[model samples]
Target: MNFEHSDKVKELIAKLEAFMDAHIYPVERDYYDFVHDHSNLWKEWPKMEALKDKAKAEGLWNLFLPHEYGEFSPGLTNLEYAPLAEIMGRVPWSSQVFNCSAPDTGNMEVLARYGTPEQQKRWLRPLLNGEIRSAYVMTEPQVASSDATNLELTILPDGDDYVLNGRKWWISNARHPRCDLFLVMGKTLPNNPRHSQHSTIIVPRDTPGVKIVRSQTIFGSLNSPGGESELRFENVRVPKANMILGEGRGFEIAQGRLGPGRIHHCMRSIGQAQRALEVMSRRADNRVAFGKKLSDQSSIRQDVARSFCEIEMARLLTLKAADQMDRYGNKVAKDLIAAIKVVAPQMAQTVADRGIQIHGGMGVSDDTPIAYFLTLNRYLRLADGPDEVHMSQLGKQKIREYNAMKARPAESRP
Candidate 1:
């Protein structure tokens, strides 16, 4: 398939890259310093707010939304948006400036796709305007979360309302001061078949009995504004109108939500790997050891070459997945999505490791972004579904196909 970027995509990429160079990259230090100086780490950093306002005014806002929302976005196709996502990936936190951050992007998609008019007006509108942020609450503390149907949270029917009770951790963006809503999943009918029992409902953050138990940490970083959090819902109540789609359709919604989310992560990860390779190559070229440039060392050269090859492979696979989604729908592209989900994180992690090795002690420290990059990429192995889980599913599917072929008559078989 032809994967060339269209003229429109190229223009958007140029705009995004220029925006990053002019604003984001230069302020990385200042942004960190501002957060460190602020006593309430959860509060929005001033520099981020300023940049967000600038980005919104410049019409670079909400580039992630594909479906038409009147005048809200350009509604670019999935393939068209992939390269732009790569540019945003160069700076991990910069996607939010253009209102394209995760969890929020996925949540917005849910509302846009399934929410009623009332739901859209109440939540989706503000989200499109960048007035607030939201989170997804699905994983639980007591289960093997890889199998989402194993989730044991309950959404009980009460007179004219539903009461939610569960414990969820790794609820990203929940700790952000501006995060005021959640798209929560729980079993609405425990007696139903496993996949058909769960449902998703929108719950406001301030509803009674909803508690933010504490912020969870990733590799000891607690000061992050989008800090992962553990939430407890003890009889938290919301109107029945909060249900999206209908009861017993949570799995369907999740499938649609995660298809886009997974590819978006891959696109950004290509950029992360690209940045790491840049750092590694520059270091190898200029750093001298034992009277020779590191670039002259055989091991260093091999790593650089390998990193380049791996990044290209991952990027092409990701683009192919995007194209399949555009042409055949997400269900038709499930295998491709799982493949890239496995490939991209490993590629980024490998590139980050090589960058760290080239930088020596400086890489492991906060002096460079390598350590953070490594941490983020490594966690992605378990993000949507773990590598092992995807591999298992893919393996089973292949085995089924092989068995079916073997069972066929000789003329019908290959």
Candidate 2:
């Protein structure tokens, strides 16, 4: 019920904001320009390493990993990491500067929590040190990937290796220059129970038969440097030791990974919505339309007010989910996680739409981040799970809870 951040978190937030102000904001345009440039596709920005080093030197690295992985984690709880993530979310690319970007964050958490010692040493260590990047290769081209049980990739056993054959698309981070690993999910026990049929394995990006078929664009943008890619795993062979957790744990690992990941996405969307609102408000204040300032108009004021309310609501819900996850566990906090995942992205998309309307032509251009915010939030609506999916599950869960409560004796009911 406590709304205030603890002193430690407040300090971390201040430090993170100071770092962002000093380094990230100044080069935001330059970063965007490089990533959008066709010549720099899949190439790491020259200054990215230097920025990351600065973030590391300032002790702002790996703030996303909740578990204490010795020297890798800062030991912050999910609740503590939420605000810092929100700050980083303001500038989408800023998360990488602090080594707190997605796919890598979720991948590292999986390795830290479930990887074998050898697996940790080989992949987790370099990932933690930000020496390389990774991709979570799960979604497939020919299946209803939202329900992961529909994934059709095959990982049959060989003498001492697993041969993977599948097609995966929308694989984020696959195009990064230093993307050295892929946490690939495929069916290893197809005859097993539906939930237990799949397994996740670590495949080296340079391994034979790991082909980059094409880069997938989001609304015509390549999202360079770490663009989403379509990959073909044609007899891709990886050692048995590369299996994560075990043969039947892919679904379990994925569920665990996404709970935290969903919260992170929601908070980042809040940041994007917040920045869009600010940009819109500032534009309204400065622009004159129909003989008066846009800010003086009722519709503009209402748009700002509604956006503020929605952003605050989404942020509070995300923090609540984070707190519940920190105190209990992801399994217990599933409802709230689903709630935020369903709510935040749509909220951000709505706010960004309003911002775009207010800014007129400039809103859709690269001059402002509102256009990017719109794209990201819209994508988020379908990224983790579509709003409809979360809504359906959440609705069912709520009904079941109420039914169980009604089934209990009157004296036992709250």
Candidate 3:
């Protein structure tokens, strides 16, 4: 019931907010300019490197990891990390500056929790140090990737190594110049139990036959420099020791990796929504339409009000999920996580839509970040689990709980 952030978190939040305002937003223009000026889609942005180094030197680094990870993380719990993530979310690319971006964050967590000692020494340490980036290759274009058990990638054992053959798409950050690893999920033993047949293995990006087919664009925007990647692994060979946790543990590792990732995504969406609302309000109050400010119009006022309510509701639900994850574990908090996962993205989209409407033509163009924010929010609904999937799962779980309660003796119910 206590929703207040701890003092430590509050202090850090202030620092983060100040950093974003003074350091991040000021140069966002230059950053995008740099992105546009680069003809090579995957080339590293030197300006981003400077900002990252500044953030690191200021000790604002790796705040997403739940605990001290090697020598890089700051040991912030899920609850403590949620608001900070929201701050980073305001600027989509800001998280990476602090070494707190996705895929890498999830990949690092997997290494910290389940990787063998040598695995941690080799991959996790450099990842923690921000020396390299990684991609999570789980979803496939050929299958209903929503059903992760349907992962069609093949990982066949061969004496001392495993040969991988599959196509993975929508992999974020795979095109980064520093992307040195891929956490690939595939079927190692198809005859095992549905959930147990899949395994996650570490495949070096440079491994032979690991091909970068293309970088998929969202809404005609190339979103280059490691936005969305499609890669093919044709007989890519990796050592037997590369399997994480063990064979048939993809589901288990995914369970651990995704909870944090979901919360992080939700928190960022909340931040994105907040930014949209801020921009929308400013635009409405300042702009005159039909001889009156947009703020004076009844419809704009109502939409703004609704956006605020939805943003607050989504944020509270996200915090509830984070709190539950901290108190119990991912398994126990899964219901809440699913609920937030379903709510946060839609909330962001709604708010962003209103912002776009408020901004008129400029919103749809690259003149403002609203267009990009809306795209990200829309993608999120389908990213982790589509709206339909989360709704179905949440609905089924609710029905099961209701059925269990109905079967219980009336007096036994709380």
Candidate 4:
């Protein structure tokens, strides 16, 4: 509940800022150009690897992880690491330099919390070392994935292995050449309790029956780094050893991993919103119309004011959620997570839209990152779970609390 970050987090923030200024910002254009120009979206750009090595050598690697996984993580708590994630969020790809990017961050948490020693040695170690990448194959093309229980992929047991048969879409990281493993969630026992029917199993990307139907685009753009993809699993055989945690426990593992993952995105969105507001403020001050600076214009000033309020509100909410997750458990903080999952992305998207408006024509064009920011932050509203899903869940939780309070013994009321 403390408002200020700990001293260690401040130090990391300083170093992270310096690293971004020197390495990331200087080549932001080149980085995007190199990756976007490739005919194949999956190919690697060597500069990314070099920058990653430099970041690792500087001791910024694996900073997103908590103390429980000291073998590979930096051992910082979620509250301590949120600020660092925000700094990296200023530039979309910057987090990857420190190996703190998503899907990877979430996948790492799952492995640390649920993987067996042998599984960890084979997959988690390489991921920690940045030797490979991964994808979470859960959402299906045929079903309404928002429910998650609607996942229809079959994980049928065969001799010594599990055979996967289904199709998944909007899967991040699936198109990357380095993404060698898939942490797939599917129904192993349809007859079990709805929440307990699904299980997570690790399937190698090159498994015999796997097929990538195509790479998907987000808002008419398929930027590299982590491209959206569609994949088909036709009797893909994976060793039973690849099952994570246990059968009928995929939702449990997912819920555990999602707490940190969702908050991390919120932290980064705050940072992005902060940067967009900064850009907007300067633009208002520097640009002039009708013989007066935009800053002097009431409407422009109001935009700045509104943006500042939203950024502060979103940041505090995220911090509160992280604090709750650390003190209690993710289950206790689920509603807060859902709240931020809805708020943060919308905050960033609004800030991005205002920033774009301030920039006028250049905003929507590739001349600035504003357009991309607007698009991606908007997409985030639908990412982990869409706004409707989270809002509905939060609404239900509030009602439950209200009803419980009303039903309590009269003497218990204040």
- Measured over all alpha carbons after superposition, the RMSD of each candidate to the real structure, in angstroms, is 2.4, 2.5, 2.6, 2.4
How would you encode candidate 2's per-residue C-alpha lDDT over 225-248 as one tens digit per residue? Answer: 889999999999989999999897
Off by over 4 Å in 1: 36-38, 68-73, 405-414
**Pairs in clash, predicted candidate 1:** none
The 0-to-1 C-alpha lDDT of every candidate, in the order given, reads 0.88, 0.92, 0.89, 0.89
Model 4 is weakest, by summed lDDT over 10 consecutive residues, at 405-414
Model 1 accuracy (lDDT, Cα)? 0.88
Alpha carbon deviation, residue 35, candidate 1 (Å): 3.4
For 1-414, candidate 1 gives per-residue lDDT tens digits of 575788888888888888999999999887777666647588788677789899988878888876444454567877888888998998788899999999899899888888899999999999988889999999999999999999888998899999998899888988887888999999998888889999999999989998889988788777468788899999999999999999989998998899899899889889999999998899889999999999999999999999999999999999899888878888998989999999999999999999999999998986777777898889988888899998898788888878786464665645
Off by over 4 Å in 2: 68-71, 407-414
Which model scores highest in lDDT?
Answer: 2
Clashing pairs in 2: none
Q: Model 3: clashing residue pairs?
A: none
